[model samples]
Target: MIQMAKQYGRQSPTTPFLMVRCSAPATWCFFSGTNNYVWESFNNPTDTILPTQVMGLGGMLFSRLTQNNYSRGRFELHFSNEDVKLYLVSRPDDHYYRFEMFNATNASESASYQLVFNESAYINIVKRNGETVPLPLISWRQSTFAPNSNNYYRATLDFDGVFRQYAYPRMRSLIDGDDQSWSVVRYLPDNICNAFPDQYGGSGACGFNSYCRAKGGTPSCECPPGYTLMDPNNKFGGCKLEFPQGCGVLDDELKDPMESYDLANISGLNWPYGNYEVL
Candidate 1:
């Protein structure tokens, strides 16, 4: 694909964009800029997709380790195939969300389904019988920044394992000198914490000993009192106890672990699972 894109770029250096379609299994189709600005594959998705991209029956989206690392993370988004539904799975193979929980799945006996974000950014799961249904909790709010921004919409399976949609304005091509400007319209998963249900054992919701919250329309993680970051570099790695698990000696016991520890009660904080024990 890169070679083809490069050849096309050399032939039409001034062209704004080129859409390439192929029959190979590795890539179905892609859009490449005449220059070097845009390169998006509708099939080779890592963790993101633009509106109108079709996630085929066997297609998958794998999250990244960190924001910077592109290697496969512990989370994945794929068609369940079992019930023709879309599911997001994390490490330990726990299912977090059924991304496509449409009523159509249960109504049809189709063995497979296709997922796609319409040009207007509406998520739909298409059954083999040609029935289309909208994903649950979809956002219908119109985009104020780019009223007709269907041409530039994005949906990503975020590092936090939340699937979200975003809109971008149609702006002038970097080299084409054509006028085109657009911005984000609307996104999904109204509440970040809501995406992480408590039924999945909280294995992929967030790091252990950490709290998950939504701030500025995004998921944020933080450690509570009496604990510090386990890996200061990776917040998702979880937190470590500031105090030792048990005193090893009389001298260790003499030094009060609770001297610096203060009880903290956080209200409205969301956990991947319930804090109360089943007992």
Candidate 2:
């Protein structure tokens, strides 16, 4: 399509802004810019990918700093190779997501494929010869309205490193003007706490000294008793010691070590990268 766009006359700058604003730009079959399609939004995607767009090999999606902050976040999904691995940049050496896209022994399946998500709420593997394999999603929400005409779909790599699919209805002229809302249709790694294993190079789901608890598919970071978060604004930010320890404080330990020290005995907590045998 890049080669074909070269043969067409040059397009005005406004033409791109208008076409890209369309609900389904793919259905319009309009190439954004005539400049060899170089300066196109599709070529440079932010966090969300619209329907009918394919995330080809080597493509990557970086999340926002926070849901409210649009700057680049610590989490990223780099489709670096065919296996389709996604690593949490907080721990670059470790990856949190993976899936094999091809079958080495299955001769019937095509090797060249594209990951496509359309009006449907799930992403699928489309082969060059029209063969397809539907990826497993937790659940397909029964559409409350006509999806193809009334709604638009998007898949986003969220701030906290969870991939979610959303549906937005065209509520330009709604009976209830306040009904404009984006509904979450699907999300990957349903259990956010389990995304990062117990044995870790970095903090598991939350930062060091912070407990990661899953509340309705979202990871909630909390400080255990006797400790406080480093930053109240940042929940995932590591926790800190409330006071100085080891007998070097104003409230010096006059008694013996055993008598002065009392263990917090917090349950369900583990050392992030501690070396300990299960035996």
Candidate 3:
């Protein structure tokens, strides 16, 4: 980002701005004396957003490549119209989830809208008048979390493509042995497998050759027999065949294809995406 103290490029504004701030995820920003922000990070978002921040219309939240990797991933949440749509980037305009707003807006009126996940964990698309255009996300459930303590909260588009709100206890508070891990307050597209019934998208909730199953509001991906995870450290990264079987193989192996490649049964399994004929 270029910062010209006196001017921006060849053009100059009526009043020369004094400061610049970048409120970003992973990357941080700071400010002291209050003068309106000529630019702010809230307007521009990353994979996660704090509860108080708002994402304007046409804003998007992109998924990360993995839990530890910050590279851009394949999932996207687009706020463009009456619905907050989640799309698979590789599959183009086909959105897996369509969360409808509480109230519809008139096409003729000019209005500005912003999306926010309030302190209580309610995702709303609100108008300037404080009217909530509810995206019909799950209702806010009361939690025992104490912000005054070391509790922290954030809603993130996870690596596995599930958008979730998590509350973590930064420092231990309880005397008894308790699970102080980040707890999921809410998540959407409840059933990841059902979201990708048709095998067409590049990869559904999980990666290719892996299937998605909701395990406590999170998508748990697993590889089947004869296949192993591509990256064991990152299970959601998908899997690949353990043994290569093709024309490149020896003639003996090709001749006894049935003996070399035996059928393996996986009950109650749903493949993310594949040809219907193969099912």
Candidate 4:
């Protein structure tokens, strides 16, 4: 990660500005001072943010390529169309999944300027002069995570593009005297499917042809029969249909048109984007 930061076209970039690689998730860029710290936005933020920081105009948060890969992914968070929104980057010129701010319709001048996470844990859209504006519906939850006033906190865009808040509690240690420990306190959107629905070729949390189901408060993917996983190693990549595309040309007697397909019906499944179609 340090090597990648060095290659970012800056000469002799050192501490106070560092690229930290976590053992579990993706890499992160951090900027720290004597009493405060922040995630330095180099125009490319991968899957996270600190509560003390601000997401200003043109600043974007992107998810990782996969759960295991640290590179950039297809999800994005940015200010656009007179509001702050979350989108899925489909094509270079195409973006989907727009979750826009509800209360900033009259304040376009201040709405897209900067998003601030005040010390009170309120995520607000504000102007250059620090005038607070309304935020998106997803960020309206009350944050009751009251820790020590000196402790640090972070709001990260997770691997699946879930916006979450984490707290680092300050405590006195026997050897270190003063320290902080990390813990998650909040996550937004509530459902992964609401953020990543099947819009463009099953473009949700579980990819195409797969459904997102919550099991024990965690999202899991499942593909219908007659289809198999596209990448066995990456289960979230979705599945591929096993049947032939065009008409079968084989001359064998068992090659009947009806015999080549398998029939299975899903009962309780809710179709993506909306409900079932009318007959």
- What's the lDDT for all of these models? 0.60, 0.64, 0.68, 0.60
Show the lowest summed lDDT stretch of 10 residues, model 3.
139-148
Query: Residue 247 lDDT in model 2?
Result: 64
| Decoy 1 TM-score against native | 0.65
Tens digit per residue, CA lDDT, model 4, 43-72: 344576655556766667877767788777
- Please write out the lDDT profile of model 3 over residues 176-271, one tens digit for every residue: 765789887667777666676464656677788887778755678888788899988878777899987575357554455565567777788754
The regions of model 1 sitting more than 4 angstroms off are: 1-40, 82-94, 99-112, 137-151, 172-184, 248-261, 270-279
* Residue-by-residue lDDT tens digits, candidate 2, 1-279: 323323257753343312333354643323445523224566567777877777666678888877688888767876533455556676776777776666534533433566776555457767767777665543322323234567778888888777777777766545666565777766666666776766545666667777877765678888877689887777766799886667633465365767645677767765654555531
Model 1: lDDT to the true structure? 0.60
User: What pairs collide in candidate 2?
Assistant: none
Candidate 3 residue spans exceeding 4 A from truth: 1-39, 102-111, 119-121, 137-152, 169-181, 247-249, 252-256, 271-279
Clashes of each: 7, 0, 0, 2
Per-residue lDDT of 195-265 in model 1, one digit per residue for the tens?
Answer: 55566554434577887787544667788888898877777767879876655345545656566346688
Every candidate's CA RMSD: 8.8, 7.6, 6.2, 7.8
Model with the higher lDDT, candidate 2 or 4: 2
